[model samples]
Target: MNARFTRFALVAGTVAVTTLGPSVQAQALPACASNAICLWRFQDGTGELYTWRGGYVDLPSRFTDHVGSFRANRTGAFVDWASGKECHSVRKGDYASNYSGRFGSKIDAVGDNC
Candidate 1:
């Protein structure tokens, strides 16, 4: 009976450790779609996500001035069209991890030229 109890306790401990271990493990951020650019409301790819395919396009109302971080999966650029802010380049494979001040919540459009 003692040996059986010990084996059960070991198995229970292993299961608990395995279950809790992943909770603290770092999770992979969502990948930006191929041939597209992505923006996030917070840094490190957290919060809301917005994706834009190839083309000249204006950001939607919610994302007009709410982009805080970005991942340029393809070649493109983002600009603040509202206040005529300068264009911010987003080269292919570029990841702006934190846009807290520079380009933060000010992007209004995505296009080939600003």
Candidate 2:
């Protein structure tokens, strides 16, 4: 019985170590250029990456409902809704690990606020 308890403790300890370690912490966002905004198709900065520079622009059809993560390398990157409202703004050096459900797959445009 003691041996079984010890084995259980060991297993629990191993799981705690593996699941709560730094490796399981949030990852650094994927790279975006100095003056660009990058959106990813998966959270934690994984999957397809789409980059944008300056200008008022519509997200290409391929990415309209696909953006999941984002990093803003420029000072005033704005995520626009189809209703022509700015739903969220990402300042320079900022990152969003995930978007809200209402805006997540609904971002229709992107542009510089400055």
Candidate 3:
């Protein structure tokens, strides 16, 4: 019984280390969060996405490592450059600003912090 308990603890510890230690996708973008305002962020490395109805937030999305296929709402969105369509999504990274104020089809990468 003692051996079993020890082994169980070891496995649990290993799982925790692997799960949160490293970034899953070398190019899988990062994680995102909803700010007080509640908006989604999506950019190359870390940016926000503006919705039509909902204002700004720390939404969770990722940037397509490919450099194209990024389209969400309108703001911060641009032609795929390669695909000609807009489609970008990325999670929080390094750092990000706050989400508040007017929230509609258009968004600014950096805005006044809340």
Candidate 4:
């Protein structure tokens, strides 16, 4: 693995299985084609200091309304449209829920805290 990929892996574990939505239309979008990367890092909101590496899905699932699980590191976590939160608080090696809707739905996107 290269440096970037290595770092990504350290924060976000290897993607075990990605589900392409039953609807073929959803697969045509970005992050669904290939080389989709999820990045995560700690932030001060104003500057950069205490940072944590996190993987970003950009576009996690190929299917809308689909719930998929991606591998995460010990300190890594996930937050999808389903979790109802915007931040990634998903726990690695455990079951995490997320909303695979269009752009993290506003109505039903409920992310759970870890």
* lDDT tens digits by residue: candidate 2, 1-114: 999999999999999989887764577786888888888877778887888888878887777867888888885545656666755666888887875354657787787762
lDDT tens per residue, model 3, 3-44 = 999999999999999888978443443333333122344333
The local lDDT score (0 to 100) that residue 96 gets in candidate 4 is: 20
Q: What is the lDDT of residue 108 in candidate 1?
A: 79
Q: What is the C-alpha RMSD of each candidate to the true structure, in Å?
A: 6.2, 4.4, 12.9, 19.9
Q: Poorest 10 consecutive residues of model 2 by lDDT?
A: 75-84
Candidate structures ordered by TM-score, highest first: 2, 1, 4, 3
Question: Tens digits of per-residue lDDT for model 1 on 30-82?
Answer: 69999888888877789988888878888877777777788877888888866
TM match of model 4 to true structure? 0.24
- Which of the two candidates, 3 or 4, achieves a greater lDDT against the reference? 3
Candidate 1 accuracy as TM-score: 0.67
- TM per candidate comes to 0.67, 0.68, 0.23, 0.24
Output the number of the TM-score-best candidate. 2
Using lDDT, give the best candidate's number.
1
**What TM-score quantifies how close candidate 2 is to the native fold?**
0.68
Clashing pairs in 1: none
The number of clashing residue pairs in each candidate reads: 0, 0, 24, 21
